[model samples]
Target chain A: MNELVHGALYGTLIATAILSTIAMGIWFERKFAGRMQQRLGPTIVGPAGLLQPFADIIKLLQKEDIVPRDADRGLFDLAPILAVVCSLGVAAVIPFSPSIIASDLDVGVLWVLGIGGLMVIPTFAAGWGSNNKFALLGAMRAIAQSVSYGVPLVLAVLVPVVLSGSLSISGIVAWQAQHHWFAVWPIVPGLPAFVIFFLAMLAESNRIPFDIPEAESELVAGITTEYTGAKFTLFYMAEYVHTLVGSALGAALFFGGWDGPFAPGLHWMVLKTLTLFVLIYWVRWSLLRFRADQLMRLCWTWLTPIGVALLLVSAAWVTFGGTN
Target chain B: MQSAWLSAFAFLLVSTLVGAGLLGAASVLRVRAKYDSPLKHNTYECGEEPAGMSWMQFHARYYVVALFFVLFDVEAAFFFPWATVLREEGTSAFIAAVTFAAVLMLGWLYAVRKEALEWQ
Candidate 1:
């Protein structure tokens, strides 16, 4: 009974934190983008636009909803909901602190990757259900992009698992705490793997440079072409949540999550994650989007081979050099 | 540990409900302006009349890429368990894993030679 209550409490708390952060993240991204573009963003909403996301939410809620006459109503409605669910579901395994994880699954890394992979499904559903050519094109591009990058992403993740000799996120963090961050240690493999993982993370989350699915200039908002009002907001929320969660996962795997000097615990994790988040934003604003062929070639030709080689090298390091 | 998964599932359920509830509320709260026009219902095709159905056959590249991805994905799945035990398994295990990766790489190479990855 005690365990059940504690579990429920933590579950709710984490959900609240994620939801709130997502709201704020939207504001932060907008404000950050505004600064980059040399303009004020959302100044009218609340105190330097801190309340902008909330206002946007309210406005979205009040906007008239629309569904295309030819759309598959059932799947169209379910896709955004499923996207949000899958995006939020990944938070369950993430450990903010040593004692603060919602679920300490032995295969936490695998679990995250699996849940991350599920995002593609809803994206496809949205595209296919809309019955729009652009949406279908976007969905097809998204699947190809995600699946190609996913190979390297999974392989890169394996580098840490091989080094730590455990699939658990916390265990990997503990290993890094005991030894050194896989990102910095074993320079030959760790750095490359981390780079591949970071790039794959960006691609997987459909951020700029890899956001071919939603290339506004081309696809007319891609998979979301048919959605309106609150439904569109749901898809928007799902994308941001996925980006944030992917950043957190990246922090946990390669950046020695929640382990830092001067201070320790969840603060470090939050700082690391936010720092990565900021970096993602910076990258988003800075880089040009990759063409579909260029994106695929980068993944299959360069990142995949590097990822596979890094995995083998890490395995060899574990077999010979030996770490805790 | 088992309880943790339950907690995770519970969180998923709660979050889904919250999301659905929010959408439901939005539907009720939002103004309903029913402008009935065939033009409003047409798919946006850059101000031009949308020719034919959007569900026509697409390029075969997507299917080809998917096949390649599945092959690599299975190889990745096999590597996870091999990774977990690599530290203890030592050199022999390294050889086996390398062989597995090498064979997969050969397949990738073949795909490359065959232009399966070519975007054109």
Candidate 2:
């Protein structure tokens, strides 16, 4: 009973934190994009648009919720909820600080990947449920892109697992704190693996150079074509939240998660995560979406092989180099 | 350990409820346009009238990609245990992982030769 109460407390706390962070993250990304493109963003919403996300939420809440006449109502309603749930499910295992994590599962790495993999289903559901051609195309593209990149993504994740000799996220961080950060150590394999992991991360989250699934020029909002009002907001939030989780995982695996020198708590983790998030945003604003064929070719021919080779190199480093 | 999973489950449940509750509240609070037009809710295809159904068969290329994904995904699952034991088991484990990867690489080679990855 005591454990249950504690669990509920932590559960609510973490959910609230994630929700607020996502809200602020949207505002920051907008401002960042504006500055990058030489325009002022959300300046009139509140002081420098500090309250802009909330304003947008309020506005979305007040809009009419539209359901298409021919759409599969059940699946259409269920898809956004599933997307949000699966994305938030990953937050359960991520260790923000030693004591701050909700649950430190033994197979944390695999758990994260597993939950992340489930995201494609809801995306497909939304696309198919809408009964729209563009939505169907977008969904197919999303599934193909996410599933293909998921291979290299998991493979890149294994590099750290090999280096740390543990599958637990906390254990991985402890290993890096004791030894050197995997991203910097063994510079040969580590650097390449980090690059691969980061690229795969971008692809997994559907950020540009990899945003072919939702290419506005062609697909008219893609899988979200038939969604409106709060449902659309849910889908939008799910995408950003997934990005947040991806950035957090990247920071944890490669960037010495929560292991800074000056102050030792959650601030370091937040700083590392936000830095990666900003880097992703910068890339999003800077690059053009890849052609679908080019995206698949790059994933299969280049990224996967490179990821496999890097994994082997890390394994050899552990065997011969005697680090860790 | 059990409590940890319970807590994780509890978190998932609470988050889902909160999300659903929020959406439900929006549904109640939001304004409804009760006047329905047959033309308003048609499948949006860039402001054009509806054509044929959208559920037509797609290209076989997606299936090929999915197959490749499944192949690599299983290989990744096999690699995880090897990764965990690599430092302790050392050279023997490394050899096993290499052989495992080599076999998978053969499949990838076959796929390339067959041009399964080519986008038509």
List the pairs of residues colliding in candidate 2. Answer: none
Label model 2 with its docking quality class.
medium
List model 1 lDDT by residue over A1-324, tens digit each. Answer: 554565567777887887799899889888899999999777887789799889989899898777777788998899999988888788878888998887777888878888888888899999999888899899988898988888899999999998998988999998888889988888878888988998998998899999999999999999999888889988998888888988898889998888888886799999999999999999999999999988988888888888888988888888888545
The local lDDT score (0 to 100) that residue A136 gets in candidate 1 is 88
lDDT of 1 by residue, B37-100 (tens): 7777677788888788889786888888888778887887788888888877889999999999
Clashing pairs in 1: none
DockQ of candidates 1 onward, in order? 0.64, 0.73
Q: Could you tell me how far off, in angstroms, the CA of residue A138 lies in candidate 2 after the best superposition?
A: 0.3
Please identify model 1 stretches exceeding 4 Å from their true place: A1-8, B34-38
Candidate 2, residue A152: the lDDT equals 88
lDDT of 2 by residue, A208-307 (tens): 9998888889999999999888888888888888888888888889877888887975899899888888899999999888999999889888998889
